[model samples]
Target: MKMMYLRRLFTQELCPVTHTDLMGCLQHSPQQLQQLLSGGFAGAPGLESLSWLHNLAPCFPLRGDQIQVIHEPQHFYQTLMQRIRQAKKRVVLASLYLGTGQLENAFVQTLRHSLQAQSSLRLNVLLDFTRGTRGVANSKTMLLPLVREFGEQVQFSLYHTPDLRGMTKRLAPPRWNELLGLQHMKVYLFDDAVIISGANLSNDYFTNRQDRYILIEDKPLADFYAQLIERVQEFSLAVSADATEGLHRNWRILPYEGTKEQFIRLAKERVTNFVQEAYQRQLQRQELDTEADTWVFPLLEMGQIGIHHDSVVTKQLLSNCIAGSRLKLATGYFNLTQEYMDTITHKCLAQCSILMAHPNANGFQGAKGPAGGIPAAYTLIAKSFYESLVRRQQNHRVNFFEYQKPGWTYHAKGLWYYLPNARLPNLTLIGSSNFGERSVNRDLETQVCLVTDNMDLSQRLQAEADRLYDLSTTAERDIVQRQVPRWVQAVVRIFRNFF
Candidate 1:
């Protein structure tokens, strides 16, 4: 009976609509999609086909009930606090940096209180060295108190990218050095549950910045991330607070025993071996959950260190989108790599909808100096991409939308793939990647490709996509072309990769 249903789901005859253009292809409205996916079969055939991704990464099987998608920023904050309070064994947090704000203070206090209460609880934090140590009272200073109090119970690692070294590292200013690379993965693990998001543990992320967050209550997934974090920590600097001087102490440690080249070589070897071992083990596992409707493939892209598994998987996924299928992509940054642009416009036959932040909705909209031109630079990039789409005559199948909420800044980044005639996405890529040149070739990035056959989870995914789309407006090529300044355009042309 299940095999028959699967066959029916995959057949072209079952689909009610078929066309080459976006409007004609995706006949069902978001409302209709929601209704169609609300309840039905226990499994999705479209998602099952994505099992091939396991060859690239370790695949974790999960039930639909294990996943929870948090929509609001406040709720996400509350949930993290609640999970920390309830945590018994371990709490691992990896973010770009922790903001210094009232809420962030409370967040640190919560971790402190949790450690004070639970005797066996351990805490591990990881942040980018440059970003965490930016200001006088930054992430490093904020975390020093915990280090002073809990000692070994609480530990943190500052991951400094080896790419920035010697003369370049010394000459580059505080904020500018971050352009080289960063530790950009965001994973918050509390014991057996893990919350993956693109948002940092900052005030804006906790309040108004729009981003995607998913809480998965599975022990294996949590353990996997915990191990991954530990591996990164091995290649990161340890933090220590001075007994009397408090925050005045300098935190530094060479990840490897030798030079920057040696560090990169050793770190690459370790990370590569770790991923390969996991993949081999996954291949050997014969007993997987037969009833499990969801599978997650964790992808890591440390291009600076020469690991590009995530980029490979991402490109493959984009290129494999069949005709009549639909792909909705959202990125806070509008600068996509040339390969990604070419894949979408020329290679992929799927009707694509890209959602990006408007100039006003960009997080860098009100910066003081050259940083302020970032929003405009992104607009210029978008304009060029739109022109390419038009030049290739792919505008009918590919479209763009700008996310512009009144009070919120857009920071969501991910991809959702829907099979032909399907009301909900069967697969989704969620994490810290913007799918830009930096993400592909410079930074340390990680994302999970969630392939789920469960209708309930699919409905939630569809609803999340709908909510973002609802707040967005169609991208007009003429307006985009006119919005950028001449200076911004020139800067973008010369420094396109850095964006």
Candidate 2:
């Protein structure tokens, strides 16, 4: 009965083309679509068999050899430094904020030297305004020296969310203000190569914090993200060193040239239009690489500014998971949006496994005050989700695991999809989203859905997923609930969306 329902759902809602028409529309053959519709595609149906997703976003084709999955934090840092040092054309970095640490200082020095060496090289950086200017000495202060040295060649923008305005903005404290919203996309671009990661430019991210990173050496893909960041900087605040201050070295901030309403409205229209036009261009392209074994679909979610391509694509992907599908999802923060949880438990028939941080492994494990209870709050959220699964008798189909390394904190967040009875994942989502409410409704997030038919890339992706899963232990609801305080549970019940 479920299979019949899924088939009907696919045909009625997802199928936009007949078999013959689909052959011309998708990179896949019509036989693959037939197999997917009939539930008989070899061992299992891979993402390549899904034609709807390809149609929903702009698809860029590239070879599997162009991609590299970096597993360790140290390697990610080293690769980033090396790429920055070698960059000759341009370097663009977008992160939540830059950390004031030795490693970060070194990173900035490397950029300075790169700029000193190549006069033609340009650098563009985008960071959240609230978080960047949080303390007396912060990310803004760290970058002002570079601006003073290089002027327009070294430009940075601080994005301020229009959500936290008026009385709330004044009353909100320093560390807590970031909970309202943030600029959370993390993209590091150097010349024609780009590294997409959830890790920030911090000492913890460079040392023991666990996260995912994917390096793609493709010019078109790099240019796409570069342009996307440029669009975001259009509405952000610019930083310039004050020449009149001279020895004082004072810096000035030039705010967006309009009211908050105007900024929000104009930024939304420009970003949404840019994405739609890119999608249309991809759809109309007649020279796409038909023989390419790998394709990338970029998903952008800026719900605060009203752009939600990522959310729409993610919901559709989850809702269309038929029987025999396997999905592995990891989020360091375990607060799944209610809609996502409902679709996984009640709508989808895929066998799903969720990996989240154990209380001991949470980044906020040993913090002070209410911030320290964050681990417990996440436990409460997970308990609620677990109860929902039990009520629907879906706990058997979906399992939970907690990642707890001895001395490390877990911050990895993404999704990996495996075809039934398959040992490897054919598709993966990697980026800065934790799938929490804040990601959905507050922050700006971006992730890419990578669909590959190349066996080598598939193997590498599966290995990355396996490594994380190997360190995780099965989560028991009662055990997790025992650690949650009553007060924490009450807090979670009241302000569930903020986390």
Which pairs of residues have clashing backbones in candidate 1? none
lDDT tens per residue, model 1, 371-490: 999998888888888888888888899889999989999999999999889888989999999999999888888899998878899999999999999999898664455667789988
lDDT of 2: 0.81
Candidate 2 lDDT over 409-494, as tens digits, reads: 99999999876676888789999999999988889999998887789999999999999999999996644455677788789888
Candidate 2 Cα misplacement greater than 4 A, ranges: 1-48, 243-259, 477-481
Badly placed stretches (over 4 Å) of model 1 are 1-44, 243-258
lDDT for every model?
A: 0.81, 0.81
Per-prediction TM-score to the true structure, in the order listed:
0.88, 0.89
RMSD of each: 9.7, 6.2
